[model samples]
Target: MPVIEVDGLVKRYRDVTAVDDVSLHVEQGQIYALLGLNGAGKTTLIRMLLGMITPTAGSVSVLGAAVTAGARSAWARTGYLVEAPVAYPELTVRENLELVRRLRRLPGGTDEVIERLALAPYAERRARTLSLGNLQRLALAKALIHAPDLLILDEPVNGLDPAGVVEIRTLLAGLAHQHGTTVLLSSHLLAEVARLATRIGILHHGRLLAEQHADQLDQHRRRHLHLGTRDDTAAERVLQAHGYHPHPAPGGGLQLTDEHALARPDQVATVLVQAGVPPTRLLTEEEDLEAYFLRIVGADHG
Candidate 1:
């Protein structure tokens, strides 16, 4: 069995279908990111997986055990931090971690977990007194307290400063690499997920649109040349002449696909020059995971 498996998982809330027949697998020692906008059912699906809520239909199994109501033991082997974070505001950072250790019956290693998350600097500070970034670090420390085999984090870096984002990213990478923790990370930050996730699953309107290896997703949206000239009409004409369909760009540039399109950028430069257009700038734009997601899920809202 895979580390985590969702088979036709379905969850409904009142008149709305929060999760609709979704299914995916998370293997051991891999970071799988679930990418989606708000209300895309990612949270609901996560809740079902953690056994916090039961699916209206379908099933979820983690570590070969079915996820059902009151299955606290199943989740005992897992660690998690939800999007908004759940921490004891009055308790100090170290106190919160100590609580988690005792709750999990861990062998008194809160210090090691705090060190792993780099939370020693503010260990004695009240959770409510810490900044947003520091609070996030404390939350992560709590999650790692038991040294779980599986880690589930939703928006782990949300509201963090640039340095905080990098710190969290590095910490998660270390956990996955050094400790061999299988992670299920959910986020709307496609760029961050692309950097850390081994595989990605795109969710749209409570349904999964696509799943692919991070490298494959990157390759699909490879860099292409964007040609901007004095005359948009003439530039489009020239690119079309070369069997290139120019994707529309907001900042007044004709977007083309493939690195091969710009293999001889000088050729297009010459064409524009001969046509008396005088090429303004030739920029290469690499396709990122966000670009691939927008392409697959589209830019329009339902």
Candidate 2:
């Protein structure tokens, strides 16, 4: 059974649709990421999935239980972190986690989660005294204290340093790979999620533009062969005469989009060599995730 299922989900506030007709399913142990920029409805969609907000149309099923207000199907087995991390400012880190432990009726694990998130150093310190990064860590620790079967995080890496980001990435990966946990996270950082999420869905202006597996992401990105020679004019002339289309690259090189060049770079090299304009540099350049995202979004509107 899928861990999360959304069918024709839609949310709107007086004509301003926050989430369009979006449908997706997350299987067990799969890390699905909702990728979009700010005001792209990622948070709205997440809120609907968590039963925090109601959708105008369609349905949401989490852990095989239909989600409805005051009737969460698997509340005990789910963990989530929404928009901004909030906590009792005066409560110490340990006290806050202890509250969660008792409220959830859990047996133990407050200390284990604190250590796991590297918050032991500030365990006794008040939440208000911790830095932004450390406060974010405490939020994550609360979500992980019970080791819930499903974890839903929004912009999970917000307010963390480079090292802390790496740590969180490793922890989530381990949780999914070693233990059987399903994750659905939202972030605008396409490049970062490209490396972490098993599957990705692109959202723009309250609509889902595209969805693809991480391994198959390369198929959606554009690729071209780059060629550079000592004599740029001669190389361009030779390429055109040989029926090859060449465009100037942004960084003082020539880019070739011809299928023949990309499929057989060796042939392209031989052609240049025979013309006495041997390429000084020949390499394939694939578009990055950010560029691909902008291109697709622009194409949708353009």
Candidate 3:
């Protein structure tokens, strides 16, 4: 059975439909990413699935149990860090983990998690004294304290430094690889999500726009060619005439779409060459999750 399943889930707030009929499945031992901009309802969907909020329509299930009825015990085997976790300022790093251990009555020591997150250095320091980066590390340790089977993290890497980011990435990889955990994480950082997620789900305007295997998504978005031209406008016009709207790129080039475009690569190259464009300078751009994300969500600096 899939670790998590959402079928036609909907959550509405007065006049606004926060989540509109989103459905997806996450299999066991896979890292699934829920991605969207702020106010896109990714959080709402996650909250509903976790039983933290009530849905206006449809259903959600986690670990083969109905979300509403079985959430309390179903979540016992789950560990989550939502957005920036709130910890008591007076509590020390180790104290926070102790509190969680006692609250959940789970087995095992917290040392493994503390060491994994590198929170040992600040273990005795009060949570309020830690930097934002360190605080995030402490929160991560708390989430994994119980070593739950399923981990749900919302923006787990937020406020993390480069080193911290790499550490969390490695830790997450180990969670799925070594401990056999299923993870569903949400993030706005496409690059980080790309590295950690095995499957990706894209959300826009409170709906799932796309979902695919990470490698397949990359393959589907791979560029056919990067056409450089002395007359960039002419190159774009030529592409437009063939019903292709290539994304704009610097140095008078166009970012070609994948095979879905009507014009063949040879035809496109020939057209660019005929239009005084330098086909000699053509090169293929390596596909990444960011490219697929930008295409689906459109370009936004924020």
The lDDT leader among the candidates is 2
lDDT of each: 0.83, 0.92, 0.82
lDDT of 3 at 245: 76
TM-score of each: 0.87, 0.94, 0.83
Cand. 3 TM to true fold? 0.83
- Tens-place lDDT per residue, model 3, 1-302, is 99999999998889999999999999989999998888778888888888989989888888888889445768788888876778899989888888889898877767877888898889899999999888888887877887788988888888888988998999899889888899999987778887888999999888899888776765566555677767777778877886777877765567776564434677777767776664555666665666667778875443
User: Which parts of model 2 have CA positions greater than 4 angstroms off?
Assistant: 299-302
Q: Could you tally the backbone clashes for each prediction?
A: 0, 0, 0
The TM-score that candidate 2 achieves is 0.94
Candidate 1: tens digits of C-alpha lDDT, residues 223-294? 778878778888788767766677767778777764556687787777778767767888877766666677
Q: Show pairs that collide, candidate 1.
A: none
Q: Which should have the higher TM-score, number 2 or number 3?
A: 2
Collision count of model 1: 0
lDDT of 3 at 256: 79
What residue pairs clash in candidate 3, if any at all?
A: none
* Model 2: ten consecutive residues of lowest lDDT: 293-302
